[model samples]
Target: MASALIMTGPLWFFTPIQVATTVIAGMNCGASTLQSPLTWPLLQDEAIPAQYSGKQTEWLLHGSEIIFPPFNGVCTVANLVMAAYCYYKRNDGLATSAIASAKLPYTALAFALHVATTVYTLTIMAPYNQKLKVASRKINASVEKGEEKSSATQQEGIREFRDAQAVWKARNYGRGAVMLAAAVANAVALKVSAGL
Candidate 1:
C-alpha cells in the first residue's frame, strides 16, 4: 500500500491545476453562451426603452469583457505546465498513462485549441466590439435629451446598427463553441495526460 501510494504521488500536485483549467474553460464557454438566449434579441434588437439600449448594450458586454482578458492569461499558464510534461518525459514514473506516448499530440492539441480561441477573439470579434462601441455613441447622440423618440432620419441608421449587433451576437455563438471545444480538450488532458 505504501509503495503504491508513493508510485501515484505525482498526481496530487497536478490534479487541482488541471481541474481549475477545465473549469475556467467552461466559464469561458458560458460567458459567450449566456448572451445567446436573451441579451441580443430582447435587450438589443427590440430594446424596451430604446434610448436605454445603450445601457443594455453595455450590460450585455460587461460579463464577457470581465472574463475574456484574464481567460487567456490562465490558459497560457495551464498550457505551459502541460507542455513541460510533454516535452520532458518521466518514463516509468508516468509510463502507465494512456497519453504517455501521446505526449506531443495532447499538448499540441491543448495549445492549438487555446490559440484558435484567442485568434478568434482578437481578429474576428474585436472589430465587431469596436463597431458596437461606435454605434452606441451614435445611438446616444441620435436620441436628443428629454426626447422619447429618436429623429426619424436616424431611424434607418439605428436599424442597420441593430442588424450589425445581431450579426455580432451570432458570431459570438461560434466563439462559444470554440471555447467549449477547448474545455473538452482540457478535460481530456486532465484525465489522460496527467502522467505525461
Candidate 2:
C-alpha cells in the first residue's frame, strides 16, 4: 500500500509537466517563422544587432520551452510521491494514530488542488496557446517593419507567463500540503506503533 501510494503520487504530479513539455516541443518545431528581435522582449536593446536579436530570441524561446515543463514536473512528482509514502506508513496501524487521522483531510485537499490545476491547464492554457501563436505572428511582422513591437509581445507574454505561473504555484502548493500531511501522519503512526 505504501509503495502504491508512492507510485501514484509521483505519476499524478509529473504527468502534467510531461504533457506541457511535449506541447512546448511542438511549438518550438514551428518557431522558425518567429525569427525576429521583437519576438522576444528581453532582446529589445538597440545595441544588439537585428541579426543577433533574432538568434537570441530563438535561443531563449527554445530553452524556456524545453526547460520549464521538465523542471516543474520533476519537483512536483518527487514531493507528492514522498508525501504518499509518508501518508501510507502513517495509517498502516490505523486505529490509534493521530497522524493517520490527519492524513485523510490533507490527502483530500491535495487531491482537489491537483484536480483543479489540471482542469485549468487543459481548459484554459491549452486554448491560450492559439493566442500566443497569433501574437508571435504579429510580433514577427512588427519586427520586419522596424517598428516598435514590445507592446504586442509584452501583452502576449504577460498572459502566457501568468498562466504558467499559476500552474507552477498550484503544483508547489499541492506538493507542500501533501508533504506536510505526510509528516504528521508518519509522526502519529510512530507514536501509535510505540504504544502498541
Candidate 3:
C-alpha cells in the first residue's frame, strides 16, 4: 500500500507538471512570435495561424494535441493497475473497508474525466486556430492601413489569451489536487485495512 501510494502520488504531481510545462511552452511560443515581427506573419497568417504563433502557445497546443491521447491511454492502464492492486491486497487477507473499495471507482471517474477534457480540448483547437487567423488578418490589415490603434486591439487580444492561459493553469492545478487527494485516500485506506 505504501509503495502504491508513493507511486501514484508521483503521477499526480507529474501530470500537473506535464500540463503546466506544456502550457508554458505554448505561451512562450505565442509570446515569441509577438516579440519577433518576422515570425509573427508566419505564425499569424500562414502555416500555423496566429493563435498558435508563440513558442509556448505552439508547444502547449501541440503538446496537448499529441500527448493527450497517450496520456488517456496511460491513465486507463493506471486505473487497471490500481484496481488489480486493490484486489490483490484484499485477496491477501487484507481487510477491506468502504473507503478502500471506493478508491477504484473514484480513480475510474478521474480517468474518464481526464479523457473527456482531452477530447474537448482537441476538438476546440482547430476552430480556435481559424478564429485566430481571421483576427490576425484583420489586425494586420488594420496596421498596414496605418491605423495606430490596431496595435492596441492586438494587445487586447493577447491579454485575453494570457488570461485564458492562466485559467487553464488553475484548472490543471485543481486536477492535480484531486489526484493527490485520491492518492492519499487510497493510501490511508490501505494502511487502515492492513492495521498498519
Candidate 4:
C-alpha cells in the first residue's frame, strides 16, 4: 500500500525520496488498474432499475468510503511524520553533506505531493460524497410500482443521484491524475537521488 511506503519514506534515508517515489508510483499504478473500468464500472452497473440506482450508488460509495478513509488517514499521518523526519534529517547535517545535500529538495517534493493528494480528495471528492450520502438517506429505497407513474419528486431525486455519481466520477479522474503525477514525481526523485 502507498501508506506503508509513505510511512517508510523517512527510513529510506540512503535513498528515501527515490524509494518513496518508486513505491508510491507503483501503488498508484496498482490502484489505477483496479479502480478504472474494473471497479467503478461494475459498481455503476450494479445499480439496476432507475428507482434503486441512487441507493445502490450510495451503497457503493459507502463501501468505498469504508476502504478509502482509513488508508488515506494512515497515509496522511505517515506523510506528516515522514515529512518532519525528512526535514529534521535534512537540517541536521545533510544540507552540508555532499551526497545527502540533494535529499532536502526531493523530500520536500514528495511531502508536497502527498499533501496535494490529500487536499484534492478532501476539497473535491468529500463534498460530493456527503451529498451522495444525504441523497441516499433521503430517497426512498423501495422499488417503484410498475403501473404507477414515478412522482416528479422521486424522479428529481433519481436525477440528482445520477448527477452526483457523474460528478464524482469526473472529479475522481482529476484525483487520479494528481496521484499519478505524485507517484511519478516520487519515482523520479528516487532515480535522481539513488541513480536506481
Candidate closest to the true structure, highest lDDT = 1
List the global CA lDDT of all models: 0.68, 0.42, 0.44, 0.58
Displacement of residue 148 (Cα, Å) in model 1 is: 7.3
Steric clash pairs (candidate 1): none
lDDT by residue (1-196, candidate 2, tens digit) is 5434423542333234334333433333234223222243444455654434444544554564565445434434533553465466555674424444444344334434444434544465445444444444444555666666356554454445434433433443443343344334333322322333
Residue 75, model 2, lDDT: 33
Candidate 1 overall lDDT versus native: 0.68
The lowest-lDDT stretch of 10 consecutive residues in candidate 4 is 141-150
By TM-score, who's the top model here?
Answer: 1
Q: Over all chains combined, what TM-score does candidate 1 have?
A: 0.80
Candidate 1 lDDT over residue span 81-180, tens digit each: 7767656653555643434445445555766788888889888887777777666666666675443355663565467567767888889888888888
Question: If both were scored by lDDT, which would come out higher, candidate 2 or candidate 3?
Answer: 3
In order of appearance, the predictions have TM-scores of: 0.80, 0.35, 0.39, 0.69
Candidate 2, superposed: residue stretches over 4 Å from native: 1-68, 75-91, 94-97, 142-196
lDDT of each residue in 1-196, candidate 4, tens digit only: 4445434443445455356445655575457435645665654563465445566667766776676555444444544554566556555554324333454465456567667777987898889888766665545642333323266655665666667767877788787776666666566555544431
Q: How many backbone clashes can be found in candidate 3? A: 14
Cα lDDT over the full model 3: 0.44
Clashes of each: 0, 0, 14, 3
Candidate 3 TM-score to native: 0.39
